[model samples]
Target: MEATQQGADVFFVLMGAILVFAMHAGFAFLEVGTVRHKNQVNALVKIIVDFAISTLAYFFVGYSVAYGVDFLVSAAVLDGSAEGSPFAKQGFDLVKFFFLLTFAAAIPAIISGGIAERAKFWSQAMATAVIVGLIYPFYEGIVWGGNFGLQDWLSESYGAAFNDFAGSIVVHAVGGWIALGAVVLLGQRKGRYTSDGRVVGVPPSSIPWLALGSWLLCVGWFGFNVMSAQSVEGVSGLVAMNSLLAMVGGILVALIVGKNDPGFIHNGALAGLVAVCAGSNVMHPIGSLLVGGAAGAIFVIFFNLCQNRWRIDDVLGVWPLHGLCGLWGGIACGIFGQEALGGLGGVAFMSQLIGSLAGAAYALAGGFAVYGALKLLVGIRLTPEEEAQGADLSIHKIGANPESEMAPR
Candidate 1:
C-alpha cells in the first residue's frame, strides 16, 4: 500500500506538471498575440528560454531555499529507493520539482509581457536566474515552506494561517509586482507616449493567436489548481468547480465592462483563473464567481489606469492582471472562505490581509533590488535605436515571417 501510494502520488503530480508546463506555450502565444508584429519573435523566444533558465535556477538553488531539500545526496535517497524498490519508490521528488518549477518560471513569463518591447534579452535572462533562484523562493519558503515561523505567527495571532492553495500571491502577485519594477525602470516603449501628452495606441498583432492562448491557459488551469492538491487523495471536486465558475464570472464581467473587446474578454478569463487560485479549494463556487467577476473588472480598470493614467506602459497589463488580481485573490480567500461567506472556514481576514500585503511588499523590494542592480550594472533596456528597429530584427536577426516578407515586400 505504501509503495502503491507513493507511485500513485508521483503519477498524479507528474501529470499535473506536464499540464502546467504546457501553459508556458499559453504564455508564449498570449504575448505573441499582444505585442506588435515587429516584436513577435522576441516574445516567443523569451518564454521558452526563460523557462529553461528558471528550471536550472530552481533545480540548483530555488528549491533548496524554499523547501530546504537538496538533491545533492545520493540518487537512492533522492529517489526514495531505500524505502521500497527503486521502481516502487519512484522518482516522485524529481517530478514534484518539475511541477513547482513551472510555477516559479511564470514570474519571468509575467514580467516578459510587461517589458515586452524594451527589455534586453540576456539582461532579462540573468534577472530570471536571480529571481527564480533567490528572490522568489525566499518568500515561497516563508509562506508555503514554513521557513521562519511566519505561518505559525499568523496562525497564533489570528486563529488561522495564511492560506494560498496555489500561487496567487506566491506566483502571480509576485510576478506582477516585480514586473512593475522592471516596467518602471525600462520606461515606456518608444513612441508609446508622445511628448505632448497623448497616449499612442500600439494595437495587438493577432487576435486569433490571443484567443488561442487564452483557450490553452483555460484548459491547463484545471491542472494548475486541482493538481495543486499534489496527491490524488487530497484532490477536491470543489476546486474544479470553483475554477470553472470563477472563469465564467471573469469572462462575463469582462465582456460587459470591456465593451466586448476581444482583448479584454480573453484576459478576463485569465483574471478569473488568477483570482481563484488562492481560494479554489475552500471558497464556495458562488463566492468564487464573485471573486472572478471582481478580478475581471479589476483587470480592465487597472490595465487602463496603468497604461493611460499612470503612463506605466506595461505592454500586456501583467501588473494588473496578475499582480492586482493575485493580491485580491489572497485577501478574497479570507473574505469568501469564511463559513459566514460559505467557504470551508479555517481562514482569517487579518492573516490574509497581512500575508497578501507582505507578499506584494516583498515582491516590490525584490524587484527593485534585482532589476535595479541589473539596471546599474548591465542595463536592462534596449537602446532607442534597437527599440525602433524592433526586437525581432534587433535581437534575433529575423522577423517571425522573414521568408514571406523578404520574397514579396
Candidate 2:
C-alpha cells in the first residue's frame, strides 16, 4: 500500500511538472508579445533568470516551509500531552517539492508583467530569491503546513483544513500582490501617462507573440487547475470540465465587454484561469464557470479603474487578474466549498477570507520593504536614456542588432 501510494504520488508530481513547465512558454509569449519589440529579448531573459532563482529558492527554503516538519511536532508544540513524530517523515517529499517548484516559477512571471519595460533585471532576480525562498514558503507553511499551533484552528474547524488545492491564493495571490508592490514603487513606465495626465496606450509590438502566449497559457492552465486532484475519480474529470467551462465563461464575458479589443479577450482568458485556480478542487462545473466569468468581469472593472481612474499603471494587468481574481477565489471558496471538505464549525468561509487577506498583506508589506530597500541601496530603475533605449542593452549585456540603436547611453 505504501509503495502504491508513493507511485501514485510520483505520477501526479510528474504530470504537474510537465504542466507547470509549459507555463514558461506561456509566460514567455505573454510577456514578450505584450511589451515593445525593443524589450523582447530583455523580457525573455527575465523569465529565464527568475525561473532559475526560483528553482534554487524552492529547493532550499520552500521545501522546508511547505512540507518540512511533521504535523505531530506542531501538535506537541501546542499541547504538551501530544507526542511528535519521531521519524520526521515528510508527506511525499518529492511530490511536494515539485509542486512548490511550479509555484515558485509562477510568482516571478506574475511580477515580470508589472515591471516589464523598465525594471532592473538584477533587482527582479534578487526578488525571486526573497519571494520563493522567504516570502512564499513562510505564508504557505502557515496555512498548509502540518504543524498545528500556527493554523490549528483551521484544522479544527475545517476537517482536512484551509484548502487551496491548486494555489489560487498561495501562488496567484502572492504573485499579484508582489507585482502590485513592485509597480507602485517602480512608478509608471515612461510615456505611460501624458503631460496632461491622460493615460497613453502602450500597444504590443508583435501580435503573433501576444496571441500565441495567451493560447499557450490557456493550454498550460489545465495542469495548473486539474492536476491538483491527483486522481482519476469522478472528481478529477469534473474539475477538468469545470476548468474548461470557466475558461469559456471568462472568454465570453471578456469578448462582450471588450467588443473590439482582442487584447481584452486575451487578458480575459488568463484572468479566468487565475480565478478558477483556487476553488477548482471542490466546486461544481457550473460553479467554476461562474467563478471564472466573474473573474473576467472583475478584470474589466478593476483593470480600468487602476489604469484610468486610479492612475496606477500595471503594464500587463497583473494586479487585476492575479490579485483581484485571487481575492475573488478566496471568497468563492467560502461560498462554494462543501462543509464536509471544510470540517466542523462552518467557518471555512471566514477562514478562507482571513487566510487570503493575510497572504495579501504579507506579500504587499514584504515586497515593499524588499523593493524599497533595494531601490535605495542599488537603484531599481534605469536612467532615462536607458529606458528609452530598452533594458535589453542597459540591464542585460545583450544589444539589439540594429546599428541605429547601438550607442550606449
Candidate 3:
C-alpha cells in the first residue's frame, strides 16, 4: 500500500507538471496574437527560451533558495532509495520539482508580454536568469518555503500564514510588478504614442490565436489549481468548481465592461483566473465568481489607464492583467475565504494584505535593480532602428510568415 500510494502521488504530480508546462504554449500564443505581425515570431521564441533558462536557473539555484533542497547528490539518492535520504520515496520529490518549476518559469512568460516589441533579447534573457535564480525565489522562500519566518510571523500575529494556494502573488503579481519596471525602463514602443501624447492603437495580429491561447490556459488551469494540492488525497473538487465559476465570471464581466472587445474578452478570462488562484480552494463558488468579476473589471480599467492615460505602453497590459488582479486575488483570499463570507475560513485579511503588498514591492524593486543595472551596463532596449525593424526580424532575422515575405520561388 505504501509503495502504491507513493507511485500514485508521483504520477499525479507528474501529470500536473505536464499540464502546467503546456501552459507555456498558452503564454506563447497569447503573446503572438497580441503583438503585431512584425513581432509575432519573437513572442513565440521568447517564452520557450525563457522556460529553458528558467529551468536551468531553478534547477541549479532557485529551487534551493526556495526549498533548501539540492540535487547535487547522485541519481540513486535523488530517487530516494538511498538510506537516510530526505526525498520522498518513488521519486515523488522529482516530480514535485518539475511541477514547481513550471510555476517558476511563468515569471519570464508573464514579463515577456509586457516588454514585447521593444526589449533587447539577450538582455531580457539575462534578466530571466537573475529573476528565476534569485529575485523570485527569495520571496518564494519566505512565503512558501518558510525561509525567513515571515509565514510564522504572519500566523502568530494575524491568525494564519499568508495563504496563496496557487501563487497569485508569488507568481502572477511578482511577474506583473516586475514587468512594470521593465516597461517603464524600456519606455514606450516607438510610435506607440505621438509627441503630443495621443494614443496610437496597435491592433492584435490574430484574434483566433488569442482565443486559442485563453482556451488552453483555461483548460490547463484546472491542473494548475487542483494539482497544487500535490497529493491525490489532498485534492478538492471545490477548487475545480471555483476555477470554472471564476473564469465564467471574468468572461461575462469583460464582455460587458469592455463592450464586446474580443481582446478584452479573452484577457478578461485570464484576469479572473489570476485572481481566483489564491482562494480557489477555500472560497465558495459564488465568492469566486465575484472575485473573478472584480478582476475582469480591474483588468479592463487599469489596462486602458496604463496604456492611454498613463502612456506606459505595456504591450500586452500584463501589469494590469497579472499584477493588479493578482494582488486583488491575494487580498480576496482573505475576505472570501472567511466563514462570514461563506468560505472555509482560517485566513486573515491583514496578513493577506501585507504579504501581497510585500511581494509586489519586492518584485518591483528587483525589476528595477536587475533591468536598471542591465540598462546602465549593457542596455535593455533595442535601438530605435531595431525597434522600427521589429523584434522578429531585428533579433531573429526572420518574420513569422517567412514564406509569405519571400520573392517568387
Candidate 4:
C-alpha cells in the first residue's frame, strides 16, 4: 500500500507537469497571434527558448533557493527510498521539480508579451536567467518554501499565513510586474506613438490563432490549479468548480464590457481564470464568479487605460491581464475565502492585503533592478532599424510566413 500510494502521487504530479508544459505552447501562440506578422516567429521562439533557459536556471540554482533541495547527489541517493522517506520515493522529487519549473518559466513568458516588438533577444535571455534563478525563486521561497519564515511571521501576527493556493501573486503577479519594468525601460514600439500625441492601434494579426491560444491556456489551467494539490488525496472538487465558474464569469462580463470584441472576450476568460487561481480551493462558486467577473472587467478597463490613456505599450496588455488581475485575486482570496462571505474561511483581509501589496512592491523592485542593470550593461531593446525590420528577420533570419518572403514582388 505504501509503494502503491507513492506511485500514484508520482503519476499525478507528472501528469500535471505535462499539462502545465503544454501551457507554454499557449503562451507562445497567444503572443504569436497578437504581434504583427513580421514578429510572430520571434514570439514562438522566445517562449520555447526561455523555457529551456528557465529549466537550466531552476534545476541548477532556483529550486534550491526556493526549496533548499539540491539534485546534486547521485541517482541512487537522490531517490527518496535511499533515505527511508517518502520524498525519496520513485524520484518523485525530480518529477515535482519538473512541475514547479513550468511555473518558474512563466515569468519570462509573461515579460515576453510586454516587450514583444523591440526587446533584444540575447538581453531577454540573460534577463530570463536572472529572474528564474534569483528574483522569482526568492519570493517563491518565502511564500511556499519557508525560506525566510515570512509565512511564519504572517501566521503568528495575523492568525493565518499568506493563503495563495495557486500563486496569484507569486507567478502571475510577479511575471506581470517584472514585465512592466522591462516595457517601460524598453519604451514604446516604433510608430506606436506619434510625436504629436496621436495613438496608433497595432491590432492582432490572427484572431483564430489568438482564440486557439486562449483555449489551450483555459484547458491547461485546470492542471495549474487542481494539480497544485500535489497528491490525489489532497485534491478537491471545489477547486475545479471555482475555476470553471470564474472562467465563464470572466468571459461573460468581458463580452458585455468589451462590447463583443473577440480580443476582449478571449482575454476576459484568461482574466477570470487568473483571478480565481488563489482562492479556487477556498471560495464558494458564487464568490469565484464575482471574482472572475470583476477580473474580466478589470482587464478590459485597464488594458485600454494602459494602451491609450497611459501609452505604456504593453503588447498583450500583460500588466493588466496578469499583473492587475493577479493582484485582485490575492486580495479577493481574503474577501471571498472568508466564512462570512460564504467561503471555507481561515483567511484574513489584512493579511491578504499586506501580502499582496508586498508582492507588488517586491516584484516592481526586482523588475526595475534586473532590467535596469541589463539596460546599462548590455542594452535591452533592438535598435530602431532592427525594430523596423521586425524581430523575425533581424533576430532569427526567418519569417513566420516564409511563403510571403519568397514570393516575387
**lDDT values for all models:** 0.94, 0.77, 0.94, 0.93
Q: Candidate 3: lDDT over CA atoms?
A: 0.94
Q: Please, what is the TM-score per model? A: 0.98, 0.87, 0.99, 0.98
Q: After superposition, how far is residue 236 of candidate 2 from its true place, in Å?
A: 1.6
> Given candidate 4, what's the lDDT at residue 28?
91
Per-residue accuracy of model 2 over 1-409 as CA lDDT, tens digit each: 7557556666775677788778888888888888987888888888888888898888767667766733324544432333553431233444545665887788888899888888888878887888888788877777666554546776566543566767878888888998898899999888889888778888887778888988988887888777766543323766677678788878889888767477778888888878777677667777777888888888888888998888888888898989988878876776666545441223367677777888788888877987888898888888889999888877765754566666776
Output the lDDT of residue 105, model 4: 97
TM-score, candidate 3, is 0.99
Which candidate has the highest TM-score of all?
Answer: 3
Writing each residue's lDDT as its tens digit, candidate 4 over 175-262 gives 9999898899999999998999999989899999999999999999999999999998999999999999999999999999999999
Cα error, residue 79 of model 2, in Å, equals 33
Question: What tens digits encode model 3's per-residue C-alpha lDDT throughout 120-146?
Answer: 999999999999999999999998899
- CA shift of 292, model 1, Å: 0.2
Worst 10 residues of 2 by lDDT: 79-88
lDDT accuracy of residue 400 in candidate 4: 90
Clashes of each: 0, 4, 0, 3
Predicted candidate 1 versus true structure: per-residue lDDT over 207-241, tens digit per residue: 99899889988998999999999998999999999
Q: TM-score: which is higher, 1 or 2?
A: 1
Candidate 4: pairs in clash: 80-88, 80-89, 81-88
